[model samples]
Target: MTESTIITDNFLLSNKKAVLLYHEYAKHLPVIDFHNHLSPLQIAEDKKFDNLTDIWLKGDHYKWRAMRALGVDERFITGQASDEEKFKAWAEVVPATLRNPLFHWTHMELKNPFGINSYLNKDSADRIYLQANERLAQDEFSARSLLKNFKVEMLSTTDDPCDDLTHHQQLIKEGYEIKVKPSFRPDKVFMIGEPVTFKAYLKVLGQKAGVEITTIASLLEALKNRVDFFALQQCSISDHGLSTLPTHFTLSLAQEQEFKTFLKSDQAVFSDPDAFAGFILTELCKMYHERNWVQQFHVGAIRNNNPRMLHKLGPDTGFDSIGDYKHAENLTAFLSHLNLTDQLAQTVVYNLNPADNEVIATMLGNFADGRIKGKMQFGSGWWFLDQKDGIEKQLNALSNMGVVSTFIGMLTDSRSFLSYSRHEYFRRIMCNLFGSEMEAGLLPDDEKWVGEMIQNICYYNAKNYFGLNRG
Candidate 1:
């Protein structure tokens, strides 16, 4: 495709009404990236990339997975290849990613910050590389500057409980324009199976929280301490990444003693990992409720499938896939356990498996106790489900089973700075969905009414839901 034709102003807007909704309503809205994997240190330092690959390719498993699929060597994907070579390797695979979201995302990223609209391929790779590098050399392409260019009003970076959050503190001290808050993610606290790792993690977490974690009560105290510390940093969100919600929600007295024994002994193995995790998770949710924090659960990912590659490249190196874990029963038990106690915080549940779309969507209604609009949210399509088909299916399921208007929308869930284009991509797709229905007269012909709802889904809903407007 030519430069002009590749990504036009109306790209993805299927009809005139779609075009109007996108251009007039959704196009210029500032992004509230409530959840992402962006590096806080990079933002705090306002780091500038030496080249496109330095910023774009490094730590991007999505591109690495695509590169691996095309038989690109590991050296180019994640190994010690030169940045230029990696960029070329990625460019060579871009054309092959035709129907993939990467095709659109790669071009959209190139079009936006770099302003390179030409399609990336082997022939054009060198030219695009030089052009993009020229821009990267400029001060405008720095990490913080790029966020400004994307009009990101606020973003929450996923952080570990043991982290000191010095970068987040630095950003605050400097009075950065964008709101960069940390979300407490204590997934490691649930890694009871890896006894040595779990014990070591507890040591660090205890030191960080100024508590000695020996029993279940101590563990909860330490976690609560970190939650309080994160709250001091303006953190109102906590996240958990699990294969599925634990089937067991409470610990029996015997099991609780077993956990205590296991924590003390080096060789004592905890018998029921699920019950132990559930006990801690249940307590954490209650703490989140006490602090009025939003809790996010990202479930149904079977990670590190390729053990050989995992051993070679470490985790988050494109070795995870969607899992088919039974979510409904455990999810219901977990949520109900909290709801019964009135401890259910504002929750967003994300399922990686597409099969669970309706499962999650409908589950949102089970406990949305009329106090909050979209209190229980079926989170936007994530991980393996962040593309077009997955996004549409998620939207369709939420619309069919729950209220779509109050839905807080898309997040990058990405490690790359360039991934902000995903918000624009989502806006166009969302506007098209609403605009097409407007044309068909499915609801109403009033653009003002419909456009306001479109704007809510795109921006306002999340702003209100997350209480970002208050600050």
Candidate 2:
């Protein structure tokens, strides 16, 4: 009947007694997004999208997986369906997504963007969808507008060594107001002998760096050149996505040569994946040390084996599943190996399995050594846990076991522009968590004190920790 109240002055700060405090604390804080999957090219080009669907729906595996789990057909999720049809299908699935985080996030997006609150389903689908599409057609909904609306002051985008970073350069030249920096992601280089994609990467890296990648030494040199190129473009973070921690190992010169020889011979190292992974991770860590960069380990994900779905839809199309990882002991050993030699970079550890949250959170403090205020961090509630419940739990775990002031706030970790709503979601959850705590007397009742905590969690902490905005 009427427009939904999108984001009220106190929407997230709804616990009336604490509402004033939240508003006072969170309103003017700057955003420091240290890790995400945002595309630097879009920010550089200051591109405008054709419509809302392309910005919100395309390239979001989190939404794609939810749609798949709701039994929406692949055509709507990943195939050639028209935007209207896809939105309609998504509308039908929205109500059924109750008790899921998607339920809340979808409504939030709809309410914030189109000012609609009626449930998205068969009855209201057409009217609501058309209005949202009309808003998308307006000039105010461009990519730059979206970022500014979300108050995204600083954003980091995941990048690969083979990238030329023309987009990053363009963004700097154009003098856009927001900060968009690249973070190196080197998973492709380590997928060697895995029977999937390393060979292709070899050819590409060779072409980009002008080197023969037949030997591990040459490959390292090529990767080094690319890293230098990225650093010149202002990239100061590196991300590693691995299934486990690297084990202790000393590679003899002969062994190193043998592994390089095996690669040239096209022999499979899948049988001994751990040893190779260990060596590669060790080498990558040494590179981080040399560059004085922050390193991120997004570990414990098992991915891309579903032949039918992967072939038809492709990687990150919802074929990834969580694994039971023995991370605590192995991770300790791995870090100890680096620590013993003083070779560890400023590191943040992100875990996927919820069961390991406590272990991961506590394990980080074990490596703190007071060298850096928050040297080893339990990264934000990732993938499956990027919601209200997820964010709260992560905040509690970190607050109770470690220092929350050292915590980095929300990251898109998304490939879509509209996914910035995730940051809003996180900020809301942070406000609610702190607000409720204050109400409960678990924390101080003073407005200034509690407000500082909220501001730290939402923005200030990440800014200080990441050394952002020095420019």
Worst 10 residues of 2 by lDDT: 1-10
Highest lDDT model number: 1
> 176 in model 1: Cα distance from truth in Å?
1.3
Off by over 4 Å in 1: 1-5
Candidate 2 lDDT at 81 equals 97
Deviation from truth (RMSD, Å), model 1? 1.1
RMSD for each of the candidates: 1.1, 2.2
Off by over 4 Å in 2: 1-9, 12-14
TM-score of each: 0.98, 0.93
Put down candidate 1 lDDT per residue, 93-125, tens digits, no spaces: 888998988899988999998888788988899
lDDT per residue as tens, model 2, 122-173: 7788887678778877766767777787788888888888888888888877
